[model samples]
Every structure is written in structure tokens, then in C-alpha cells.
Target chain A: MNEEKKISGIQFASLAFISRIACAFTGIPNLRTNLPTSDRISVFLIGLLLSLLLALPVLLFIEKENNRGLQNREKPCPSGIGRIILIFYAAFFVGAGILAVSRLGVFASGILLQKNNLHLFTAILIIAGAFCAERGLEPTARVSVLLSAAVLGGLLFTGLCDVGKMKLENLSQPFAGNIPIIVREAFFEACMNVELPVLMLLAPQIKIKKKTHLLLWLPLCFVCISAAFAVAAAVAGHYADLQVFPLHSLAVIAKTALFERIDDLLASLWVSCTVLKTGILLYTAYVAARTAVPACKKRCFFILTGALVFGGYLLLTANIQFFANVLQSAAVPVLFLFATVFIPLFTCLKNGRKEHKEVAKQ
Target chain B: MKILAIFLCFLLTFTGCSATVGTQLSNRLIIEAIGIDAQEDGFLVSVLALHTQQSNAANATETQDSIGQVFSAKGKSLSEAFAQIDLVSGLVPLYSQTRVLIFGKEIAENEPMQALDFFIRNYTLRESILLAVADAKASEIIETELEKNTLVSKNVQDILESGKNNGLTVAVELYQFVNRFLDETDAAYLPVIKTQENQSGKKEITHAGIALFAQKNLTAVIDKDAAKGLLWTAGLIDNDLLSIPFKGRTLSVAVKDCKSKIRLHKGDIPTFSAEIQFSCDLIEYNTDDTLLFNLQELEDVNRELQKQVQKITEEFIRTAIRENGCDCLSLLKKLRNGQPAYYAQIKDKQTDYLKDAVITVQISSEILKTGREVVKPN
Candidate 1:
């Protein structure tokens, strides 16, 4: 059903960017809304920098440990630690996918559909994402490039129309309101971007000069997300203070000479982008499943991963409040564990502690 | 597992449960405008909605404008009012096409932001809807009809647009209103409308200057000249006409263009000055003063006219600041923008800064054309 050809560097970069910033484009968190628009945007950028920095070490460790294909892990040990790690990776992917779909659900219901309609749309999306993941990375990466183009174009189109309405002076004010809250929001926002751990899991699949290509995608995503927040702040101003999805609201209010509201267009485009993002995460989950069970065939891995994800989506989303609480509590610790503890420990075990010495010298 | 995957795929495609039905055109009553007024019990909400059924198709063929009437309801909250409206209006009322939002004097003075909050929070309303305060009841303004089958909402929108062009009122859209309202000092202003009965017994609404607000209270209603001065500082002034009394008669000048720049002179206490420059073409010269035909004489007249404009605008500014305690010129914003360090020193006592600060207004007018009858001063 799919070709085995390795995707190009540009395609990988596209996929990486689409997955990382898809949610960020929705908005930076509104937790510290009292801070000036300038302070809010600055904090989000700072948090984005923190997220990137935290993710980089994990990325390097994964590349150093497994320079070859991503599918390779280890024979199931009697100790079962490797199995545990693989399972963790799979669970993280599925968990992140569930949350991403739930976010899309919130947006869709709020903008265009009823609550029940959004659930059905989410179901359709999950099944479609699983189907795409079953095909392979090549197709997924290819679709991501096209979807990235659409998402970027939609964002740019909506942003350009609001330029006349925007007051550039809105961004000139300094951090005058609340410092501690702004700092907390900055870190909380950093926790929202899933790129960090996703990249760590998919490091071996990256073929192009790892340092160069990743450098291209990561900062590109960082700047794109930061600019989106800055644009929303400048365009919407005090109005954006309470909106659940500021960027989408910014689009809803933006009007060109020919059209009244382009928000519908923007929502449709984001739906596609979010779906593509889900597909990539599902592919990552499938790869994790294969890594854990060497005896599992590609078809069997796809079916198992898809089944587990669909079931998780159904069970976890029954109560959104409970899911939100679970996600909020687990966000910081889980991110730290995968990025800091898991990466170094696994890398040292695979290549011996001497590899750590070499890495330090680098 | 394969069977499970296949079964799920089958369910996803085949067992199609229609998640939701989209709003149909026939089911929705498109709202053209909305009006809010304060009542003794709660709030009265009125909407000018499109009538779905065509009474006579042949007569309706030529008219592209939708025929509408104002349907009103009373409730404690905006949502509750909307629910009452929905119950009365059989079709679902949609607000995407709402062009004007009229606020009655009571509502605008008592609860402007709270009323505006409902519109802002409702996803159906756009940020560009024209906002105005009704000098009378908002429901009366909406229910009043006009010639050419024009909706009262459309008429109000046109009035604001044309009045802004004529320099009678300031141009304030929904976003600009909220922007100005959220400024450090809540001194945002909106155009005021009053309904008058014409000789033909038809009701005609007129935009009478601007209604200034201090927070949620309607503090004062400034006349056209003061409104023009306020607009000149904050917005564009287009097609403004000026009349100057020259030797025994009046010389009317049509303003072609104008620009204003505020240069802050920080002293022991900062003094702000506005330098306004305007270009005008003399349209009429009623005085038969023989010297008026000379170019030199016309220049002298223009110099005198410039002084008069400076005096008028300065007086308007003084009244706005002293009488109403309004920051009509945004001096605080300017100072904060230009001299941040100086602003920080006076930040603690900012509320009193406008009262104490000395503002100077200077006007410079250039005569673009003296007309065919050139005036030369002796």
C-alpha cells in the first residue's frame, strides 16, 4: 500500500514544523493575561526558547545512540526496561494525539458545529489519521508539506487583512503588570508545544545532516509560532484577552474588501493541519509499537496501534475535565522525564558511559 | 486485530450518524441591525430582521434591499432577551449581517460596556459594525422608516460615514470604540442621533455632534465644532468647510487637506502644543471690499482666518479638558510614547496630569486658490 522510499529533507522539515507549531498557532496560553500585550508575547517567545533548549539535548542523545534507522531499538530483555521505554513512547504518542484531537474538537464546536457534531468529526479524523499512518512516513510527510503550505497561506492571508486594523503601538509597552504570572505562563506555554518529545522519539528516522535540518525546522517553528502570537496580540489587542482561541477570533474579525469573515476558511485549513499532525503522531506511535515488539509485522503493528489509539480517544475523552486535569498535572514532569532522564540514561546504556564523555567534549 | 481494524473502518464509513445539521437559509431570519435600550425592569433588545415570505413577488423583483421591521423583547440579560426574540421570531435570528448597533441614552450612559460585551462575545457580530448613541429611545430610532425602503440601520451607517466626511462627527467603529474605551482614561466618544418629525409627518433622524463618555457615564454632548476639533486630533478630517468674516462680508473656504502634529516641550512641567496646518480654496467672497480682488488682501484675510480657527479649536480643547475632564488630545499617550522616562516620574499622579498640563494650539492655513477674482492688499 506504500512505497519504502526515504522522504526528502524538506519534507521532514515540513512535517516537523507542522506538528510543532500547529497548536501554538491557536494561541499562547491566556493564564497571565494581565501582562501587557508586549510582555505576553515576549514571555511566550521566551518559553518557546526554553522548550527548544530543553528538547535539544534529548534530540542529540537519540541521534548519537541510534545513527541508523528509527525502527531499531533492542531485543526484549529479561529485565524489560527497553520494553518499558518503548511502551512509554507509544503511550506518550497516543496521549498527545488524544489531546490534540480534543483541542480540535473545542475549536470546531465553538466555531461551526454543535458539541455532538464535533465528537463525530473527531472520530472521522482519528480513523482517517490511523489510515494515513498505516501507509508510511513518506505519504504522511508529503501530505504535511501540502497542509503546511495551506496553513501558512491561510494564516498569512488573515493576518494581512488585519494590518490596517492593528495598532503597532500596542506592542511598544513593557512588562508592567505581573512578572511572576508572566513567567509561569511562559513555561506553561512551553509545555504545550509537543515537538520536544516527539522529535526525541523520531530522531533515528531523520536522515539529512541531523544538525543542519533540525536547526532549520526547529527555529522556523519557533519564530512562526512567536510571530503568530505577536500578530494576534497586535491585531486583536484587549479583545483577545478572554477569547479561548485568540488567533481564530482574530481571523473571525479580519475582513478583506471581497469577504466579510475569513475565519471559516481559517478553521477549515487548521482542521486539515491538525489532522495531518495527528497522522504524523500516529506514525510515530506505530514506530514505537514496532520498536517494542520485534515479532510484530508492519501490518500487525499498524492495526494494534490504530486500535489502541481509537480506544484511547473514546475512553479518555468521555470526561474532558478529567482529561484536562490529568494532562495539566502530567505536563511538566512527563516532559522533563523524557527530555532529561530517559534520553541520557538510555543513551549511556546503549553506548556505555564513555559515550557521555565524548558527548561532553563535543 | 485486523478484523477489529476492518470492523472499525466499516463502522466509520458505513454506520454514518449525521453529527449535526447545518443552519439552512430558509430556517434563519437574517438580522440587518440590532438596538439596545434600558428599561425599568431590565433591558429591551430590538432587531431589524428580514421577512422571509414574499407578499407580492412582482413588486419585490426590483428591490435588492431586504424589507425589515424592528422586533423587540425585554429580559434581565442579553441572552435571555435574545431567547425571547427567538421565541417570537419563528425563524432563528442570525446576526452576521448586522450593520449598526444603536444604544439608547439610558443604556449608553448606564451600561455601555456591559451591553457591548454581549455583541463582542457573540461570534456572529463583526468588529466593524457602526456604533452610535441614540439621543432618544433606541427602539424608536430603529422602528422609524425612511424613503427608498432603506433600513434604519443602513441609514444610520450612512449618516455616520457622511457626517465623518463633513467633519460633523468622529468616525468610531466597534474596534476603535473598544480601543479608545480601554485607554488609560475612559474618554471614548460616539456619534449621537436624535429623531425629528419632518413636515410630511415622516420621522427623520439626525446625527447631532458626539456624545462623550467618562467610563460608562455619558458626561457631555459636544457640538459639531468641538467634535471636529476632537476628530482632527484623533481621526481624519475630510471636506470640512470654513467661513471667515472679511471686510463687511464672509469669505467661505473649502478645506482641501489638513495635517496636525503634536510636539511635546518638556519643562519644569511638560507643555504640549498641537500645530495644525490646513489647505483651503476660497469658494465664495461675499464682501465687495475692492481690496479683496488683490492677492495680497486675500493673504491678509487668510492670516486673520487662521487666528480665528486657532482660537476656536483651542477654546474647544480647553472646554473638553476642563469641563468634561476628557483627554480629547491623548496627551498622556503622547507623553508616554515620546518621553517614557519623564512619564514614569509622573505616573503616580497621572489622573491629575491632564488638569494641570498646559496645552497650546496653533493653526496655519494656506490659500490654495484665490478664485478668478484675485485679491491684492494695499
Candidate 2:
């Protein structure tokens, strides 16, 4: 990738933020974590801190690899090991992308169309996402910046419209649930931060002017997510538990003198964000596949990754029962930890050992 | 060529490229209000829907029915009943514009969740839609013909809104009702509507009081005074009229501004203390004594007004909590917030907690200004 092809840190943060928002709007499928509604903010903040701690290895890897451009970096391990790692990352991104697309399909069928099957909508969104991915990271990052602004503005507008409806009586004491349950719920929240892996994969493509620039994204993302949950809890009160998508329900009830039933408009905006997230994921998968198989053309690998994601989406949507089971299982969080934390930590250790050997030889 | 292909894709996606024609607005029956009543075998659903064919100004003046038409159906379930309306009306029923949902006395008492499940589960209905209970059959209220060129649903909505503004009734929205219904510690309440005839023999919908629900059943119907007390403790009172008898003379005061705070003090059983500060302006007085002009006399009237307010507030708290065992004041919610440990211990015995819990009311009132006349006539 050329210098101009790389995106700025702000654009990268925006992409990550939008991706987290998409996941939140799709509904975090952590049914076992029964934290109180009012405790969601504190739980999410704790989850966010855990995610930041998990990203430390990736941050170290990025700083060490900063001097080496995307195309010039040497593998920390042997070529075969590097290829296996790349394949693992490719598989992880495809799985994450599939989940994102399937969630969008479920949301569309459940809320917007009120129909059982939304294959056509899902296909159209996947195709749009693939096309955006084919445009590469910089363009997607730029588009993410604009979409992030729109999403933030829409949330602020909804919150302001709902401020009068929010009652302090609706909020329960934070950490009122069992301490172990609260910790488990926070862990589940941290597991949903799949954006951490995406950040690691795209770090080489992001030009960070300062380390603090990278530090700003996690807090910003969690703040928005927690605020959204808090507002929904306050406005909807206990009624939020009855809803599959509380934010969407909140948007439905959110009315001003000017706009009535703004949920539809917000739903559209959320769909756009989901598509952008899927695009970024597909692009990252393409990058991994290209690195694993240097013989394949960039466009070919991109197309291959897109096809795989769409196929996975169709499979999951077709077998929604299985998909639901997968969401409830521990596989997703395990995969997230493996891809984001385990791999980066392994590479960081390998590089450190190699440098230590060189220093000892001198 | 790529741009052209993308544009074509966008066009097809946005337009939905369907072979069948979309349902036009005129062909769609826009439901404005829905009423549900419990029957022996099933449920009856009534809808006040806009008759798009007669939705013209000229047609509206011809008959009051032209403004909106009422349709009813019976089925084993609410979904079945609502589905039958489309068959009966020969038009697609659109619920996005629904303004109110009214439950008949039987359904409200028997099984409100049966009727509520449909509205709560339906994605088309807005959560902000007004919820009320009819004193009689919901269909009667839905079919009532008011003044010419007026919608009964709109009239009901306005009546509920007006009642809320005047602090006579609590205008419960769908979300608020569901929120309370789902909370184990809190009781749900909805404004009650009844049809009455005016002096000119015109039927009008009026806010009766408030219907309180314990869990799923309609437990009690509080009168206007009790409702006023509930509103005062909840800090929902605004511009309410209060009349006090002071030394054989009646003084009417309009509440200008009111603020309330409820605090929970933990003990073996939790106690709730409500502090209400209100300011009122004298609207009318029957007293003719010129001593009313004295500052001390005004102070005496203020103290009397404060006493009257305290009496109303305390009576409401007692009736709702001790007598009826209704936690409509959300005292448990306060306990949960202020004393979570005690709340958890008593959450299972919510009714017992309400019955045993002590509630104290404190009210302070300020008479801001007298009426336009400074002095009484000689």
C-alpha cells in the first residue's frame, strides 16, 4: 500500500467506533449476563477497560512495526508460521463479518420488514459492502468518518428529545446485581468488542501521529455505547427488558414536535453503519488472505473474501436456529480473544526474543 | 460503466423492484384508536379507522361518521381479532398512526396482558400512544359519536391530555404502563375514560379517574382526589385547582408550580417521606371581609391552604398504599434505589411490604397573588 492509501488515526477510530455501534444496535447476544439495566454503563466501562488492557500487546506490536511500512515488514516467525497466523486471522475476520451481516439480516426482518426472510436485503447489503471493500481501506475509512458523524448526531438528537422522559427513579443502584454476575456480564461485554481485532489487523494501514491518538478510540467508543444504554434504560425503564432491540424501541417512542416515528430513519442509519462495518471487516479479511497467499492478485482475494462472507451470511440466516445457538455459545468470545490478544501477544514475544538474541550476539 | 452499474443497483435496491403494486394510502385503513374487550370464548377488538373515501372536508360535514368509521371483530386471540378487521374492512390496517389504545373494563380486570401483548409486540405501534381504560365496553367508547366533524379517538386523546395538564388524571402512555406492569414492586395505572351526555344531549368522553393494576389484574379504581394525591407525590401536578374552606368562606387557588421529593428511610420496614413544595395564586374567594387585605390574614389563608394540601396528600398515600396495597406511588422503586438490600429482602412480599410500609407526606404552599380585585365590594 502506498503512503496516500493509508488512513489517518482519526479515520481509523471512526471506523472502530461505527463498528462497535453497529454491534450494539444489532443487540449484544449475551443472554447469560443478567446485569441490571442501570448497571450497564458501569459494566460496559469495565468491559472497555478490559478490552484496552487486551489491546496492549497489539499496541506494542504496532509501535515496534511502525518504522516498517506495510509492504516492507518482515515476518516475526518463519514463513509457514506466518502463513498459518494469517490464515487464522482471515478465518476470524470472515466469521466476524458473517456474524455482522447475519445480525443485520435479523434486525431487518425483526424490526423493519416484520417478515421472516430478508434474503434479498441481506444480499444487497453484502454486495454494497463488498463493493466498498474493493475500494480499499482509505475510502472505507473516509466514509466511516462521515457515517460516524451522522450516527453521533442522530444519537444526540434522540437523547435530547428523550431527556424530559428520563426519570431518575427508573435507574437502579450500580452494581446492585451479584458481584460475580456483574463481573461475568462485564466479561461478556468485553468479548463483544471484536473491533479490537479489526484494529490490530488495520493498524498497519493507519498512520498514527501520536500514541495518544490510538488511546482515544476505546474510551470514546465505550462512552457512546454506555451512554446509549443508560439513556435507553432511563427512558424505557423496565420496559426495555421486554424489547429485543431497546434502542430501536427507544427511537420509536422518541417523538418531538417536528419528527414523529424517527425510528425508521434511525434504523436506516444503523443499517448503513452495519454495511460499513461489514465492508471494513471484508477488507481486513482480504488483506489477511493476500498476505497468506502472495501469489493471488489483490482484487481476486478481495472478491474471494467477499464471496465467502456472503456465503456464510446466507448459511447462517438459512439456519437461524443454529445461528442463535452459535451466538449463545462461547465460541465467539473465544475466537475474539484468540485473534485479538493471543496472536498479537505471540508475535510481540517472538519479536522481542529475536531482538534480544541480536543484542546478546553484539 | 461501473458508475452506471452502481446507479442501477442503487435504483433497484431503493425502489424494491417488485412486480406487485404497493398499497396506496387511500386503500389503507389508518387505525387511529383500538379497543379491546374480553368475551366468554375469545376477545373482541374494535378499531376507529379513517375512512379514506369519506376523508374530504365536504364529506366530513355531511355526517360525523365520515370523519372515522368503527369496525369490530372477534377471535380467539388479539392477532386473530385484528387480522379479521382487514377482512371486514377490505383494506390494509395501518397502526403507525394509532393515537390511543383503550381496554374494556372486563379485559382490564380479567387479563390485560392478553390485549396488551398484541400492542406491545406489534412493531408498528408507537410506544408513546396513550393508554386508557374504558368504564364500560371498549367498543361503546370507540363507536360513540361526538360533535359533528370530530374524531372520538382524537377527543379521547385530548381529554386524557387535558386531564393530565389539569392534574385531574395521569395520562399513562403505552411504555409507562408496560414499564410499571413489568416491575414487580410498582403497580400500573391508566387514565379511565367514560362517555357522558352533556346538557345539550351530546355524548362526550370524559376522564373518570385512574385504574390501578396489581400485577396483571385491575385491583382498584382511585377517585379524582386520590389521583390528585398520586400526581402530587409523583411531581406530575400542574395548574390544578384547589379549594379550601377558611373560616366559613371558600377560597379557590390554582397551583402555579409544584415540586416533590420522596426519600426512603430504611428500618425493619422501609418508610417513605414525600416533601412537596407548591406555590398557588388565588383564583377566587367568597369572603367579603376587608381583613383579607391585611398581610396577616393572607398568611392565615396560606397556612390553611397548606393544611388542606397536607390532608389531601396524606389521604391519597394511605388509600393507595395501606388500604388498597397499590404501589402506584413507586415506593418500592424508591426503596430499591435508596435501600437495595431491604428491597431485595421484601421484593417477593411486595403486597405485604406495601401494606406494612409507612408513608409520611409534608406539604408547604405559598399563595403568590390574589385575584384581580384587591378589595372586596362593600
i-RMSD per candidate, Å: 6.5, 4.3
Q: Count clashing pairs, candidate 2.
A: 0
Task: List ranges where model 1 is wrong by over 4 Å.
Answer: A1-4, A31-36, A73-79, A114-116, A210-212, A295-327, A330-333, A336-341, A344-350, A354-362, B1-21, B55-66, B236-268, B271-316, B334-351, B361-378
- Model 1: per-residue lDDT, tens digit, A118-142? 5566676676777677777888888
Clashes of 1: 10
True-contact fraction for model 2? 0.39
Write one digit per residue (lDDT tens) for candidate 2, span B172-205: 8899898888887888999889999999998888
Docking class of predicted structure 2: acceptable
* DockQ of model 1 vs. true complex: 0.29
lDDT of 1: 0.70
**Residue B67 of model 1, lDDT score:** 70
